[model samples]
Target chain A: MTQRWKLTIEYDGRPFVGWQRQDNGLSVQGCLEEAVRRFSGEAATVHAAGRTDAGVHALAMVASLDLEKQCRPDTVRDALNHHLRPHPVSVLSAEPMAEDFHARFSCRGRSYLYRIVNRRAPLALEAGRAWQVSVPLDAEAMQEAAQRLVGRHDFTSFRASLCQAKDPVKTLDRLDVERVGEEIRVTTAARSFLHHQVRNMVGTLKLVGEGKWAADAVTAALEARDRAKAGPTAPADGLYFTGAWY
Target chain B: MTQRWKLTIEYDGRPFVGWQRQDNGLSVQGCLEEAVRRFSGEAATVHAAGRTDAGVHALAMVASLDLEKQCRPDTVRDALNHHLRPHPVSVLSAEPMAEDFHARFSCRGRSYLYRIVNRRAPLALEAGRAWQVSVPLDAEAMQEAAQRLVGRHDFTSFRASLCQAKDPVKTLDRLDVERVGEEIRVTTAARSFLHHQVRNMVGTLKLVGEGKWAADAVTAALEARDRAKAGPTAPADGLYFTGAWY
Candidate 1:
């Protein structure tokens, strides 16, 4: 009997082309699928909750796959981790799931975190993990601006032009901006997001943080309903897919 | 005419042989010295508060150097950082210092942080940055054991045999262990440390953290006055040269 399993995973996204399997280079999904094939002797495809862009990390991404081999939860987790080694991807836990459960379609919510190192010096330890913004940022101003985007709204101005989502409306649950020492962190949650919504919102808020735009400017950008009205998209290095709620 | 400058630096030590210059691979000191040569046309050596081993990292390492070129503090800091590009090193700040000030000899305190990822999964985001101990760790036991190493004592057991310090007896100002989420953090401060002192102590504490030894075992190991009586030296990956006080 085939068993469906849900896997919680973490990875450093620098090496992968992105979460989706592409012909150009390595992807996190491709790596996990290879590990699964090696362990189960089946060419099963693993599905993730989100298709993160290139250089986007994941703290606890959930994925689902079917396996023909019968194994305990611990054995599945350890075996996948062992085979995935040398690559910076880890399966944190594996659990049996009902056949109806799905990693993407059945997901209820998603959360993300973005880190900005606000300093004049170049980063050494956190170079690839965080975005280094040499300009001093007023995190309080960013926090004030972030509140403007915190409810049900059409986010076309913040969404990527290439986004395939049929609808532009998404309910944002949370959008928090805070400063911890030299790093400014932005965290957000939503039932779903149009592609690049988080990064675009962060980039727009950054202008407010730098005092180049007033806090109310974000409202104007959102009301414009045009992608060009919003600020530039932030780099993918700073974005992380934190978790998903079923 | 020479200007004495005190520089605060941050480095990812994985690419370096160590903090000191050596004939082997690249060294952090050698890179700084070369940066100084490129920036100021001087071959002056840079001295650091601690000589971190390979694979170690630094958050705010203090250093001292003499520059014959007269420049503003910001210029020196910025220029040195510009030249140290492509290497995982950065000059965080440069300040004018009195000739009496020295990074090594005049330092009054040194602090270190050791990170342990106490989880079954192999680390992905923190792979090279933290030590992964698959066995569940008892952080409370580790904390109590760590207290035994605090205070003035002959720490020969924790000291590396090749340490050149004349006296093993030194007062440890702090040796605090605490659990932060999945990480077991060991923070310690002292006027100075014997070579590999922090790593050795952390290794010993791991035994207690694993329930393999009682907390009182630390006392016996300290009293033994022999390095062999202590646990094996922990890997340099988890150790960070946090800061130094003048």
Candidate 2:
């Protein structure tokens, strides 16, 4: 008999070539699948709630897999963590889930956090973990501009060119910008996102933070429905898949 | 004409051998001196507020150096940071200082922060930045025990075997243990500390947190006045030289 397991994972993402298994380099999915193979002796396919891009971290990414052999939830988590040694990845928790449950399909909402170090000096402790923006940014202005992106609308201005989503429309549940000490954080939530949507929105808001674009400009860009009208996509270093709510 | 300058620095500390200049490997002082030489064309000797051990990080370590060239404070900081490229050490700020100002000798108080991630799974993003303890620790109990070591006392038991201090008696201004989510933070301040004294005290407190040793046991260890009486010294990964006050 086979049992389905739900796994919560955390990864640095600096060394991974994204969440999907790729021929070029390492992937978080590949690591988890290999760990499952080693521990359960079954060549399993691991699926994640979000397919994070290269250099994008995850705090509590939801994933699911099936194992032929019977094992305790703790055993599955511990065994996978042990096998993923020195890879900057950890299986935080594991639980037996219903066969009908799916990590991606069953997920109701997903949240992400993007970190920006607003300082003149370069980063030392957070070298690869955050995007260091040398210019000082006004978080309040960014917050106001971000509000223009919320609600159901066509996100063609924010979506990547290669986005595979069937529709360009997405309902953004929340988009907030706040400052914590020397860092500016952008938090967002939605049922699903177009490729590079979060990063592109953050990039566009940064212009407002720097006093280059106003809140009305963001609304204009959204209405224009052209990717070229919006700001550039922010780097992947600062993006984090925070959680997925069922 | 020589001008004395004060520098506030931040470093990751994983790549270097410590703050002092050494022959074996790279040091924070050596990097600063080299950067000074490259920018000012002067063989400057950089001094630090604390000579941290290997693998110990710093958030705002105060240092001083004398340069013969005339340069603005901002220029000194920017040039040194530019020349110190690729190294984890960074000069956060620079200011002109009086000749009497000394990085180590003139410091009135020093503060350090030790981070411990109390979680079952291993660290992912903060692998080398924090200590990962699998067992759950009682932070309140640890805080209560820490008060026993406060005030002026002979911390002989907590002193390192290689400590160079002339006397073991030192006044501990503060020792606090607090829990934030899954992380335990130990913050301490003192006029001066014996080598490895903070780490030793934290290690002994861990025993009390784990229920292996009682609060009185920590007092007994201090009263023993022997190095072997205290717990083992904690690793250098979790320690950070936070700041120095003049």
Candidate 3:
């Protein structure tokens, strides 16, 4: 008997190509599939709620797989974690789910967090974990500017050139910017997002934070509806897939 | 003319053998000296406030060096940082100091932070950054037990066998334990510490956290004045040299 299982995972994206399987380099999906095969002796295909880009971390990535082995949820988690050793990945939890459950299709909303170290000194402990902006950032200005990107709209200006989404329209539920000590955090939630949407939006807001652009500039950029009109895309190091909500 | 410069540094200790120069592997001090030589063209010797063990990180470690080259503090910092490229070390600040100033001798107090991830899943993003304890830890118990070694006392039980301290008696200004979500942080401050003192104390306190030992056990361990009476030394991964006071 085969059972569908939901797995919540955490990974350090520094060592992975991306969440999707690719031939160029090691990927999170490839590692998960290999771990599944090593433990359960089953060739399983794991599906994730989001295909995170290279150098993008995940706090709780939702994934699903079907396994024919009869084992406890704890066993599956531990075994997968054991096989995934040496890789910067961990199976946080595994739960048996209904056969109809799907990781990507059943997900209703997704959330992400971007960390910026607002300091002149280069990063030491967080070298690869965060984006360090040398110039002082005004969180208030960025917060006000981020509001322009909220709500439903055609986000072609923020979309990646090679994005495969059929529609450029996306409903952004939340886009908040806040400061924590010397760090600035950008949090966003949405039903779905166009490729590079969050990063492009962050990059644009950063211009506001740095006092180079006004908050209203974001409104104009969104109205332009051209990818070239928007600010440059932020680096992937600062982006984290926080979670997926059903 | 030689100038004395005081420097504040931050480093990820994952790839370092320790803070001091070692023959076997890379060390933070060696790297800093090499960076100094590369930029200043001087064979300068760097002196640090503390000699941390292998895998111990630093948020703001104070060090000092003498150089014959005349340069601004900012130039010293930037040049050293540029020369230290690819290494997980950063010179946060540099200041021209009086001839009497010294990084180690002038230091009055030192503080440290030890992070424990109280979770079942193995760490992914924080693999070598924190200590992961699968079993739930009682922060309150640990805090209570920590008070036993607060005032001036002989810390032979917690001191490393190879400690070079002239005396085992010392005063602990603070030993605090607090929980934040799934993380437990232990903070301590003192004028100085014997080798492995903080880690040994944390190890013993962990036993109290796990309910394997009572708070009174800490009092007994301290009174025993024997290394074997204390818990095992905690791994160096979780320790961070927070700062050194002038």
**Candidates' DockQ values?**
0.92, 0.82, 0.81
| Tens digits of lDDT, candidate 3, B1-246 | 999999999999999999999899999999999999999789999999999999999999999999999999889998999999889999999999998998999999999999999998999999989999999999999999999989999999999999999999999999999999999999999999999999999999999999999989999999999999999999998999999999
Question: Looking at every candidate separately, what fraction of the true A–B Cα contacts under 8 Å does it contain?
Answer: 0.92, 0.68, 0.70
Check candidate 2 and list the clashing pairs: none
Q: Name the regions of candidate 1 deviating beyond 4 angstroms.
A: none
After superposing candidate 3 on the true structure, give the runs of residues whose Cα lies further than 4 Å from its correct spot: none
Docking class of 1: high
- A149-220, model 3: which lDDT tens digit per residue? 899999999999999999999999999999999999999999888898999999999999999999888999
lDDT score, candidate 1, position A222: 92
Sliding window of 10 residues with minimal summed lDDT for model 3 chain B:
B36-45
Per-model B-chain TM-score: 0.99, 0.99, 0.99
Query: Which CAPRI quality tier does the interface of model 2 achieve?
Result: high
